[model samples]
Target: MKKIYNNLTFRVLTAILLGILLGHFAPSTAAQMKPLGDVFINMIKMVIAPIIFLTIVLGISNMGDLKKVGRVGGKALLYFEIITTIALVIGLVVANLIRPGDGVVTTGLATSGSAEAVSRYAQQSAEMDWMDFFMHVVPSNAVGAFAEGDILQVLVFSVLFGMGLTRMGSSGQSLIRAFDRLSKVFFNILNIVMKLAPIGAFGGMAYTIGTYGLAALLPLGKLMITVYVTMFLFIFVVLNLVLRYYKISLWQLLKYIKEELLIVLGTSSSESVLPLIMDKLEHLGCSRSVVGLVIPAGYSFNLDGTTIYLSMAVVFLAQVFQVDLTLAQELTILGILMVTSKGAAGVTGSGFIVLASTLTAVKVIPLEGLALLLGVDRFMSEARAITNTIGNTVATVWLARNENELDMKRLRQVFNKEEIDPLANYDY
Candidate 1:
């Protein structure tokens, strides 16, 4: 009994249930818990920049092979594109088949969402420039990137800085040692912050249930069901096949990351677990260089869940308004999402904005229908976040195997036994 109570996984799970009950019974109080989640997420975000900068720079300096860096990066980007496109197509196919919004009465669509909020997202979407996303990759202000916690910008700078370090040869040894110690220090900070996971989980869940309420799901229950069922199948069937081909067990990997999954489930923000996931993947046998390069890059370019949600949301809106989209239009959605979803992560409310951008480009679906998704969007975010985290983890492992950077012997040893604590090494 004492052991179970001391377990983070069990504690988080308990917090989630308590949150749900409190939200159901005392909504006003539950709503005030928002700060708990917000503060915890911010605490996690606080360490992200330094960790990414340090890890990538450390990995690259140790690697000391500029060609290998390029090859690894090229491979990760290619894999992200292929897998995310598949995710978009799968979402479209399922939404078409399920038709989640087939019979919804359109009369109440606008009434469900705040017009001000709808206008805000639409305006943001209109201002989104694909070129700007590309330009920001080479951040003009290095301090600003870290200040804003822009992972993509930091990654770009880290790669360049690391390349510079690699070229310095033996003279760089002292600096490399200093960076290594700094890395361990930040990791230890992460270990302490993680102890608050249950509080964060409780607060996040409570706020969602209190703000949105369980009743919000009923109006769009079919759509919610379709999204959840689709993501579940995608994880169990589609991703499982990827693992089976690579000779790894999906269930085992999921179990190993169970604590991280529960945290993400509660927070509805995968960023909550970004640094922790990168660390766990390295401990699970993926090469540090691959984990550092692929995971952070994957957060931006490889958001499988966002793509799936964007595709399905468009289809749902089309069905709601009874606007029949032709094959070419659907393909247009697939194309636009493949690019725009890359910009979806790392920003607040970016998913809806990205959806608006896709719909605006398609020039078919009614933009106002986006307001309809507002009610249940928060509820569905968990599915999106969980799938994205799992997808990135799998991508890192796959890339490691391809690059011969994975230690298969250690991987098997960890899985062959009970769940190994991913943070045992960082626990100071």
Candidate 2:
């Protein structure tokens, strides 16, 4: 049983089969099981702020040469900004052309009941302002930010502390070293916690499918399917282009991190894989500083999947309402998304929040469109998290290669090596 559970293929297949079977026949029990998924999500969320803080500050301060941190970070941020803009545009273009949400005449699309409950919750997401978004990044109390699980705030402080460490000469070096060691300890803890991913995956999937079954997807299946398909294409084709341009093998990278990817697929939160991916990227020859800085930053800005969803959903709403937009209006939407989407990493239900915020930013779409996506948004969150992980992972590698910071021999060894146990020396 342990062997079967450890086998990725076996675990995935078993989970899917069992989840479907339970979802089909015993839905009430499955609905009651949602707490398990909640627990897994909370566990993943629990680590994010601290993990980001420890990793970023330690990764930065440990560097013997801090100058390159700025150089690498600048380049990576630039790359992220460029690609995210393109992603927003692509989503808008495809959505406008396809018009998946147009003229649906969705009856029973009321702002009440289950959808209303979700919409009300989503409305809370809609209320956060852009100024508030910026203000939220500067922690009012550092400890409070961690308690609240605000990753961006933690990241902002980490960068400042790391730079201060760099400037403080030897005295700060000792503290930085301590943080570095602490970061390693946290990673080890995370590694141990992640061993339970299959269980979490099984529980989460069983609960979701068992409760919702295929019926819940009926009303919004087209939108969900469209988003999923577009996300898949973006990961394989668009991300592959970026990877191949850097001479990285997509297959090799995927193969090397199969366990981490599986955990992401199962848990549906990229945050769950942060530690594992950091370790994997380092093993793949990206400089630790590059991985440390770029990844956290990427989380906030380089959300390729979420960007795709925002673009798709916005136009989708417009089409649904049969509203026409001028070229200027579309560009304004793109610009607003560019601002609102960045630095939004680590917000719970942030994709929806960002989508709502983006819609608000453009000032053309009614907040009502957010109501349309309420029922199905939970299903799409996993895709957003997974694609964001892949995009950031690829971005880290590409940035490393661009800076000539990658250890080619180590990368080849890490990605190409095979062993009796896939987890061997692959510890996060």
Candidate 3:
């Protein structure tokens, strides 16, 4: 067990060091690493829809009642909305106070052409109106949606299908049981996929280093540092306070899931850890039903990290463009983000869209600010994924405790038991 921990640590540190060195000394070679990141992302993309579909179907079918799923889902979403709004507000307040983007005007930093790019992307995105967004959710063909790998649309279909199965009552229970069996199969597949994480991590890091190089990172280093510090504060301090209030040790829980967190950091895709998180929460003693419902919903709705990024990036863009935002207008961005950021779930680059939307709402920063950050966005994205996963994970365990679905004693035992035998039996 210690060897596994040691190896994982070594892989992570090695990736970071090699990436930094290559990014600094051989940027063109580093640029070639872009495909490595693509491969890693594709590996994750390959499984996300299947995992979401299976988990939801298994969770709902097990409940044996569609209405119960609705009730639980409604409550879970309500919690997500409330927490996500709080995250947005916190981000807005921080960005306004710090003004990380202020006094920053440099053509050489990266993507100086973003001003024009923003105009072009906006015109194109504006073509995607409310009707288009709503209609896209319906999916002209379910199979096609899966083939295309659209998560929200797939989720929409899964909910309806699961509900239909529930209404079938006894007959549906048979199939639901089947789905429960299949859920285990899919989870096994997920395990196989996760084995690729180290390579994914290496690819992701190499590409980041090769493209941006370490030196380019220096220009916006303050913004990166500020965002990271803010993320750490939220995870350790804010989350720690909440966990402490519950009489749980935050570090204990984190240590229990260190492997999962490292996988997320390497992949930069929370989806990569979806199955593992479900199992971990179960091992931690959250009821399967709550873990199934809340964690997936959190992916779509409770993206605290992405919310923070959108708020801060917009403020930074305004600073770069030298546009002054009134207090009222900044508040407006916070409110819009509270809504726009909700619908687009489990979508990579969704943050950029949210940022574009916020920029449009405020009419201060141009959409081009997205293009500016596009280069280093992947680098920051790993951090965003890490923070978002931590927030949602903590929220799940904490809420499960409140819902009486968690075993507090088990949580403490799992966390506090210092003698972890790597060869120790793990239920999964």
Candidate 4:
């Protein structure tokens, strides 16, 4: 009983249930709980930049082979592109076949708060310039990058710092060891921040239910059900097959990271669990270089869940507005989404903004249809975050195996729960 009470998983699950009850009975008070979740996420974000920077620099400097770093990064990006494309195609096909929006009455629907939300996303999407985005990846000042908490910018700086350190030969060894110790310090900080996850989980769930209410799901129940079903199929079928080919089981991986998934489920933000996932990947026997390089990049480039949601949301909206998209037009939407989806990486409310941008580009679907989804978008985000988390986890492990960077013996022991202390190998 004491062990169960102490388990992180048990605490999170209990928080979720209590949150739902509170939201249902005392919504006005529950809505005020947003700060609880915000503070928790802020605590986690405080350590993320330093952790990523130190881990990447240490991993690269220790490897002492820039060629291998380049190869790992190249393969990781290629794999991300291929898998995310397949996810887009699957979402499109599933949406067409199910026609979740068919027969929905769109007449006289009140936009109310939703119209403002749509306008906000539309403006953000319109302002997003591809050239500007690429330029933004190269930070004007390294300190500003970390201060702003820009992952891509920090990633760029870390890689260059690591490469420069590699060229220094013996002189870099002392710095590498220092950075390695610094990484451990941040991980220790992570351990401390993670203790508040239950409160974050509770607050996140309460706020979501309180603000939206369970009744909001009733009107859009069909679309919500379809989205959940499609995501489920993508994970168990598409992602499972990818892992199987590499002799890894999706179920086992899911079981291993159950705690992180629950936190994502409660928080609806994958960023909340980013550091924990990176640490787990390393513990699972993936080399630090691969985990450092692949996970951070995957957050931006390999958004499997976001792509799937974007593609499906577009088709669902078209159907809701009684618009018929010809095969060529649908293909055009797919092409536009493939590019626009990548642009959403760092932006807030990216899913809706990406959908708005896609509809604006296609010129067939009514942008106002977006207002219809505003109510249920929060519900679907859990699925998107979870799938994105799982997809990246698989990508890191698979790439590590391909590069011969994984420790098979350690991997077996960790998954089998035979390792007495998982962090022992990392010299903790």
Clashes of each: 0, 1, 3, 0
- Which order, best to worst by TM-score? 4, 1, 2, 3
- The global C-alpha lDDT for each of the candidates, from Candidate 1 onward, is 0.89, 0.75, 0.73, 0.88
lDDT of 4 by residue, 345-369 (tens): 7778888888888888898888889
Candidate 4: which stretches are off by over 4 Å? 107-111, 420-428
lDDT of 2 by residue, 249-294 (tens): 9878877777776666666677777767887787676777778788
Error of 4 at 39 (Å): 0.7
Listing every candidate in turn, what is its Cα RMSD in Å to the true structure after a full C-alpha superposition?
A: 2.7, 3.5, 3.5, 1.8
Candidate 3 residue lDDT tens string, 1-428: 67855576566656656766776688788767766656766766777777778777766776676676777778777777776776677777777788788777656555755567566656644553445567777778999878988777787888878777777877776777777788777777776766666767666677677766666666677788878877787788777876787788889888888877876776577776766787888777676767777787677777888887777887778877888888888878887777677644544457766667667767766666676686667778877898888888988887777666787756666777644444543231
| Model 4: residue 120 alpha-carbon error in angstroms | 1.8
Q: Highest lDDT: which candidate?
A: 1
Candidate 3 Cα deviation (angstroms), residue 59: 1.5
Those runs of model 1 whose alpha carbons end farther than 4 Å from true positions after fitting are 109-113, 418-428
- Scored by Cα lDDT, where does model 4 land? 0.88
* Cα lDDT for residue 54, candidate 4: 89
* Clash pairs (backbone) in predicted model 4: none
Question: What's the distance in Å from true for residue 306, model 3?
Answer: 0.7
The TM-score obtained by model 1 is 0.96
